[model samples]
Target: MDNHEFESESYEEVEEDDVGHDESPQVITIVTTLPSARSHRLRTRLSLPDSGYEIDNVQSTVSANMLKILKKTFSIPNNVFLHLSQDNDLPSFPPEDKVTFCSDFFRFGVRLPLHSFINRVLCHYKLAPSQLCPNGWRILVGTLTLFRSMYNDDHSLAEFQYLNCLKASVCSRWYYFHPRPNVSKFILDLPDNNKNWKQKWFLISGSWGGELREDGVVRSVPTHFGIPGLIFVLYVHTCSSYASLHV
Candidate 1:
């Protein structure tokens, strides 16, 4: 929704702490829902202490002040919202109606655990506070940064898509599939004549801790959880090594 559509009635603000010092502003918490019909609820806690600014949890409310600030500052969509809960448990899969934005090779959905999501948002918020608001703008900007990085890869769009799909499939608890075969084929199909294939393969392999030997054998690294279900990384390393030797 456009920023102009945000009116005063779209959010509610609550004063959590009274102003004690002249330099310290009251701790205010704003709660509101997104503008779209499918928009989720959001809560933003703003604390203007003498040292600096701080953001806390998400809550419920009716006014649009926070939403307006977020829209004007970050241009975030209604599909994303802040969830400030401490729970780390995640469902087997994201909900059918949930929205997702990927970052750092991870697919973060609305239904994903809130702790990791909030931490990622906070990292960007600390770097560029002026570009973000207490609303979900931090998360939006962080997600955009990740998306841009993925797009900057020199590989073909199809390869990029396959990598993203492979990452999502591996990282998601609910994604059940045999990724090894497809991953192997994708690696083997890379052009042996391209020198850049080695670099691309290294990036993919390093991310998943897979390795390729000089003789072209691909092996998976041990993970804390167990043997990784997705072995596409092995293929990537092998392809990269092959391209390097051939080129």
Candidate 2:
């Protein structure tokens, strides 16, 4: 189980004729371990082909019993494709190209070209890029808070307040960036506004996902490949085959 002793091949040296489009591009595989409350471990394998990448697994084929166990453990969707590189030869991809994550696991980063992926992640999650940072953080924090409140004992009011709190958190965080024209001065003139001050401004803004876009997409399209272990495996394969580019 040494990290250094991953599956790898020796460098065979790329031939002069292997430099151009006529020659097949190198194939890289990434294997990863995904943490889930369900099974003891969910191993995943990803292979990057010249055209694109595919996911697989190394353990026994995911049977009905295994899937049922997973579903009982986690409320995740049941229909998932599982493959192992050992069953089928891994695919390949050009070094210059990249793979984009269509799933919730990837916020804004691509899978290929590790450096670019890291850079994009830092910019989207950590760095303040323009005015979108506040809204982005609001969504992130609100989602986390909502998950936390899920453990609360059944109370109708508590559930309602939980949703409201999530909305409020998102709206308040965003308001720090874009402040609305206040009717505060006009509050004295309009006494009704003062009395009904606990308005649903936050709900209107935070709940409206259709009105706004998440990174230029109409919806938050998350590609659920299921296991991180598969991805980790593929990444390791890619690195291991670094010298095999010549072969």
State which candidate has the highest lDDT: 2
**lDDT of candidates 1 onward, in order:** 0.24, 0.25
lDDT of 2 by residue, 43-85 (tens): 3334333322222111223344543443354443333322222
Encode model 1's per-residue lDDT on 1-247: one tens digit a residue.
2323322211011112221122322222223333356753332323323212211111223124543453345534454452212122111111122211222112212222222333333221121111122123323333344545766523322322232221111121111111232443222222223222111100111122122232465432221111112111111122124211110
Assess the local accuracy of residue 44 in candidate 1 as a C-alpha lDDT between 0 and 100: 32
Count of residue pairs whose backbone atoms collide, per candidate: 9, 27
Q: Which ten residues in a row have the lowest lDDT in candidate 1?
A: 197-206
The candidate scoring highest on TM-score is 2
